[model samples]
Target: ETVNGSEDIDTSMDMLQRQKYHHKRAFEYISQALKIDETQNSEQKEIAINLYQEGINELSRGINIDVWQGTGEKWIKAQRLHDKMQTNLAMAKDRLNFLATGKLSSRRPANLTIMNK
Candidate 1:
């Protein structure tokens, strides 16, 4: 009898789920910040920025998990979620810089663009 360590898939899936949870939390913070008047909600903005950064950290960790033995679906899902996290992080950094200096940072390429639609 032989035991194939199939726990890796479970672990990877768990990581992806946790990372998605973090991303959702950050999004909620951003939404809350946006709903408030920016003139009087600096504290909320700061909190949102912090949460976004935390989410980015979690995503970084989650995407780095060893998935060599896991299914391609897990890897694909992780990559897609990681990409979304990057965009969200850029938005967060831009907001933080704007709050601090009244300008958007140019460190990251714009993740968003205007559309004719």
Candidate 2:
């Protein structure tokens, strides 16, 4: 079997690559939101955190669909995306807590503070 001058397998592989690219973009967006949250002042941090968490939750739902209903390759990609999103969510929570209180407990390297010009 062939598709568009490539084997059928290659066509599917191409689609999978596109899907993975979209998934990676979603992860990047979530990470960017977390970075934005980290730079927010105490008064605005709560709202920023809430928004970031919402985006994470939406991404998780999309991942669930991809893992359970998508093709095998997509399922594997979704699983990896989910893991990355989980890490981003944890980082967001840590930043939220730090903003709520004066204590910063994250042992990892500090994230660069995002500044709005």
Candidate 3:
């Protein structure tokens, strides 16, 4: 029983590491997408944002699984970070949409206004 429990923990840890690896890659993609959008086109940026959001969702699920497996603190920290990242990503996407459509209704910092000269 003890050996089986240890093996389960090891498997869980490996899965967690894999999730973290994917999360890091997603973050890199997001950064590259932003840079590309600034100088090239917006399509890649949108694609990257979508990929990042999907990655975030995957990470959230991994964290939930970890919590269910008895890893509480790590799961909680992962969840908190995931929430923050989601909020930031949403704000960024909203800003991008506003720039594309001249519609700030869906933008965050809800009171954001432009002062024109």
- What is the lDDT for 84 in model 3? 58
Q: Candidate 3's error at 70, in angstroms? A: 2.8
Comparing 1 with 3 on TM-score, the higher-scoring candidate is 1
Q: What digit string (tens of lDDT, one per residue) describes model 1 on residues 1-117? A: 113355765676677677666666666656655555255566566665565455456545544544344456666676677677767666656665666576656554453333322
The ten-residue window of minimal lDDT in model 3 covers 108-117
- Per-residue lDDT over 3-113 for candidate 3, one digit per residue giving the tens place of the 0 to 100 score: 447777677577557656655765665565466656756656566556545544544443343333445565566556556555655655564565456576633443445
For model 2 the TM-score comes to: 0.46
Q: What is the lDDT of residue 85 in candidate 1?
A: 70
lDDT for each residue of candidate 2 in 33-89, tens digit (9 for 90 to 100): 666665765566666666666655655554444343335554566567667766765
Per-prediction TM-score: 0.58, 0.46, 0.51
Candidate 1 ranges beyond 4 A from true positions: 1-5, 37-69, 104-117
Off by over 4 Å in 2: 1-43, 59-71, 106-117
lDDT of 1 at 86: 67
Model 1 Cα RMSD, 1 decimal: 6.0
**Separate clash counts for every candidate:** 0, 0, 0
lDDT value for model 3: 0.55
Clashes by residue pair, model 3: none
